[model samples]
Target: MKTTGNTILVTGGGSGIGLALAQRWHDAGNKVIVTGRNAEKLQAAIAGRPNMSAVSLDVTDADAIAAFAKDIVARFPNLNVLVNNAGIMNAEDVSAKRDLTQAEATVVTNILGPVRLIDALVDHLAVQADSAIVNVTSGLAFVPFPKAPTYSATKAAMHSYSVALRIQLEGKVEVIELAPPAVRTDLTPGQSTREGYMPLDDFADEVMTLFAVEPTPEEILVQNVMPLRTAEANGTVPQVLERLKAL
Candidate 1:
């Protein structure tokens, strides 16, 4: 994927990883637009970033998604990059009395949200000379994080969807799956300060470097995420599950 000269839209760009990525893309000379449910946060995120803009979007809202897609394409016809990054992370105790609320939201936002948006924009993307869809999944997809079960499950489903989407869009649009490790971000409350999470700046820089490469790989696996990325292949699911449960 070409790093510059593309109009890119990043969901959940109000803060954390999504914000960091949107900023990086803006700095790299791309026409970057960010979206989130919080209008204030979205505005704040793009503040003073002349090359970037913000739109209020609730990915979980089906009607809003279709309207937003239509408006976005009409407004920014040059758009060619879509980064499906909006998601929610929650820790659930399966053994305890469980409420399906968070899990349902996770499936809707992390899985259905991207699929819906892709359906809305695929036609526009296909007509463009060069286009890319970047899906932000997680390392937990390969090895579930016991506590954040629903979040992990959603990412795993997203990974599978991305694989099929790539094959289907073979020559029309490039599909990239960015599976992140435990990064210093507030994906969950206080997750940013967690002991083993990668420093936000470091992770962001490395990710930008990977994208800068002339031909980006289908999967963007940074060093920290590599272990989990290949965990399934090594028959380490049981071991990884135990470690996560201990946490």
Candidate 2:
């Protein structure tokens, strides 16, 4: 994707990595529109950024996404980039009594949400000369985090889906999968900040820099995520499991 001059729509752009990326693009003179579940947060995100706009959207709602796609095409005809960044992470105990309903909610938001959004916008994206779709996955996709099994599985599914989407849209649009390591975001509440995940601004900077140079669709893994990728590629799942246990 081109580094600048594109109208981009980012899901879950109210806070964390999504807002950070939106801010960077807006500062670079691009038109940026952000969508999230909370109207208040979305409004706050674009308050001081003249080039940035916000829309309230819940990715988990299929009908809502269908309507959103139409609204986007009608309202933001110049939009060429779509960022699938909304996701949820939750810790669940498999052995203990658990509510399957809660796990399903995570699956819907993390996996089905992107799938539905892309399906709704694929045609619109194809019509653009320089279009891109960015899917924010996670390092846990390669190696599952025991505490957040459902969340990991959803990200793994997203990673797989992104690969397929890229192939399907080969010449139509650029598909980039950004698999971030633990970032200092609200996704983990207080834990992420305390656990030394990459700072939000630092990760966003690296991602934008990578986009400026790379033309082809590829996975952008930040510093801490490299080990997980390597271990998975080398068939060292057991060793990685041991390391996770130690953590």
Candidate 3:
């Protein structure tokens, strides 16, 4: 993926990792458009960056996603990059809970949302010269986090989907999975300032550096995530899984 001169659309760009990435791309002379569910948050994100624009979108709404894709294609004809960053994370108890509504919501937002958006935009993307699809998954995908069981499962599903999508679109469009470790974002709330989470700016910087390089279609893993990726490759994933279960 080229770092500059591309019209990029980032979902959930109002805050956290999404906004940080949008800001970085905007600064690098790219036409960046960010989308979110909240109008106020979107406005706030675009206020400081003149090169960035904001669109109101709720990825969970399938009908709204369809409309958004049509409008975006008509409005920004040069759009070649789609960043599937919009997602939700929640903790739920499966044992005591009567309803799995929270888990269902997580599956919808974290898994189906990106799938629907990609389905809606693939045709437009295929026609573009150097199009790319960047899917934002989590380090939890490699090893589940018991506390956020459903959230972790959804990300794992996304990781699987991204691999298949990349293979299918091999020659037509570039598909990249950005599996971030615990980052300093509202997604983890109190844990953002904790010991292990990577700073938002630092994460964004590393991603930009990776993007500057040509089509390397590999998962962009950061700092702490390297150990997990390495362990999985070395067949020590079972041990890592046991450690996470203990957590």
Whole-model Cα lDDT of every candidate shown, in order: 0.92, 0.89, 0.88
Per-residue error at 97 for model 3, in Å? 4.1
Using TM-score as the measure, the top candidate is: 1
TM-score of each: 0.97, 0.96, 0.94
- Model 1 alpha-carbon miss at residue 52, Å: 0.6
Model 2 TM = 0.96
Worst 10 residues of 2 by lDDT: 188-197
lDDT of 2 at 202: 86
- Which stretch of 10 consecutive residues in model 3 shows the poorest summed lDDT? 209-218
Candidates 1 and 3, the one with greater TM-score: 1
- The residue-by-residue lDDT of candidate 2 on 196-241, one tens digit each, is 6788888999888877775643898777788787886798988887
- Writing each residue's lDDT as its tens digit, candidate 3 over 189-227 gives 576677657888899888778777665546887666776
Model 1: per-residue Cα lDDT over 1-247, one tens digit each: 8988999999999999999999989988999999999999899999999989999999999999999999999999999999999999988878978788888998999999999999999999999978999999999999989888889999999999999999999999999999999999988888889998899999999999998777888998889988788878888878777877787
Runs of candidate 1 exceeding 4 Å displacement: none
